[model samples]
Target: MSLNFDPQWLSRYPAQEPVGGAVSSCVFCGIACGDVEAHVLAETADTLCFLDHLPATYGHVLVVPKQHFQDLLDIPEESFQHVMATAKQVANALRDSCGASGINLVHATGQAAHQTVFHFHVHVVPRYDGDSIVVFPRLADPTRKHEVAQRLRTALNAPQPPKTEAESSQA
Candidate 1:
């Protein structure tokens, strides 16, 4: 399916401009632009899916937007939705083709969260029985659970600030 994106969306993000044929600093952008070689699985109007070079599992794949977006916050809502829809299709293919018992959709946003690549992408990992990958190892503390929930709820209930002129123009 084709993506419905604002024509001026790329103009709003100056850093997304390509150098030569690709965004020089971001490898994912190069792949998307066909400047870099990758074992591509699928491609859509707004997204690309390919095998991970350093896969955690045999059929591990990455689903990314064709345009350059550094992180989750930088991606436009329409582009992000297309990426997710593509990821879901990839997950199903992995399970059917790779004989995976389960699937894990992993997305890391920042350095502290173990995001090595700056580009906005989702890792579609196929999980088999007895796999050694430990996605989440931290234990939750029950004592502060109520306080944490309240804090998150308060933030969710807060009204968003009005967009500036620059932001409105981009939209």
Candidate 2:
């Protein structure tokens, strides 16, 4: 291998899928299971949408596919479209609920992608002038990182899918 680094060289690599491990366990999975308090915005056969437990903004929400895939590559194309379509629905709902100017839909696939939770989820943050939350993320303590990672890993190990057909309808 050449010692020289090149950005273009990295592009040659094919994308990778999420590997299930400890990080798959997250409290968010509990929220997704209705074990915790979350303002559910939408749910489809392939996806479910809810407010972010830790709000990025007043109306921050999340859209997750029903299947427990950690990252994008693990998601089937149909599930991907369903998740994104649900995200769009949540964006509209957030606009109506919060009366915001706009919304931002986001996702992080890998650790490098800032995917704190291993389960695949899309963020829908409502944007408005003078909002309390900032766009930037705060840094975390490195010492506690491993412990926190372990906790999340345990939580997401096994996830229950949406319980009923009614639960899979519009928000």
Candidate 3:
């Protein structure tokens, strides 16, 4: 079976720098550092919330850590918590201001998850009735629920590995 694929497809997206290291080429890092212009919404010492230029909805907002982190796994626990708090605040504001009935807090981690930006960010998408935006369209396989749960439980209960030098330094 020949699959039509382009190995260089990732090159079309922005270059990703190392975790915890800020690079000029990273647009999110630039925005967080005040080097790039973005529609500012809320700013805290550890996080920044801004309007997405290409919004999924009318009041789409992005909450990100000021310090560069490639994705969820790379971000420190404290920083990730702060980002989540800021995202909660943004979500509330979006719901209240936009009169949205519901909100979707999305955080895509890698290329397979459609995360275009390398920075760790949570997209606060305000939703209304019949918006036609389908984030998760997959039907659940009820038979595999217990099997999946057990796998997840096992992984969650497993002992955590020691952090590397770079990871320790970041913390």
Candidate 4:
């Protein structure tokens, strides 16, 4: 596919820690340590599902392997199966809980594709006719991309507070 580029937005990103480096440099590794408002749907030795912060809609969620893997090819076949199965379960829950018509599953790999966090996550964004969520358009302006990454970084770095009974189900 032909790609379009925008330079202005790309200029705003802060220099981030490298992906798949020493354990301390891993961003996803830190996610569980804080109370960053993740609505964790399920967790297992192999995988976890949690609500997406930048939801395409209310029920947008993400599924990932518990073990950090930077890209799709890096995931072992069994772990991939477990992650996908959990994603499917979450999508069904979204339909029941949020009245979603359908879901969109997505993943990005490497810096060029904007997989900023460097963790293999499958996004299960719910779809409705009037909802803002849609598939990729492939025109990356630096402004919005930078803004999104900044927002996510802020959320990821936020403090961990204690959880309530209602909030405990997802965790």
Q: If both were scored by TM-score, which would come out higher, candidate 1 or candidate 2?
A: 1
lDDT string for model 1 (1-171, tens) is 454433332234334322333457788988998889999999999999999887788899999999888788778888999999999999888888889999999997765555667789999999999997767654566799899999999999999999999978877
Higher-lDDT candidate of 1 and 4: 1
Instruction: Supply candidate 1's per-residue lDDT for 153.
Output: 100
| Candidate 3 ranges beyond 4 A from true positions | 1-22, 162-171
Query: Which of candidates 1 and 3 is the stronger one according to lDDT?
Result: 3
Candidate 1 wrong stretches, greater than 4 Å: 1-22, 165-171
Which model is ahead, 3 or 4, in terms of lDDT?
Answer: 3
- Candidate 2 lDDT: 0.71
Model 2 steric clash pairs: 22-153, 24-156, 25-152, 25-153, 25-155, 25-156, 26-155, 26-156
Candidate 4's residue-wise lDDT over 13-127, tens digit each?
A: 4435445445456555556544344667788777878877656577778888877776786776777899899888888988998898888988877777666566678989889
Supply every candidate's count of residue pairs whose N, Cα or C atoms clash at under 3 angstroms.
0, 8, 0, 4
Q: Residue 58 deviation, candidate 3, in Å?
A: 0.8
**Cand. 4 Cα-lDDT:** 0.73
- List the candidate 4 regions with Cα displacement exceeding 4 Å: 1-17, 33-37, 138-171
Better of 2 and 4 by TM-score: 4
lDDT of 3 at 47: 94
Per-residue lDDT tens digits for candidate 2, residues 63-114, read 8876677778766667788888888887887788779787877787786765
Q: Please give the TM-score that candidate 1 achieves against the real structure.
A: 0.82
TM-score of each: 0.82, 0.60, 0.81, 0.66
Q: Find the 10 residues in a row with the least total lDDT in model 1.
A: 9-18
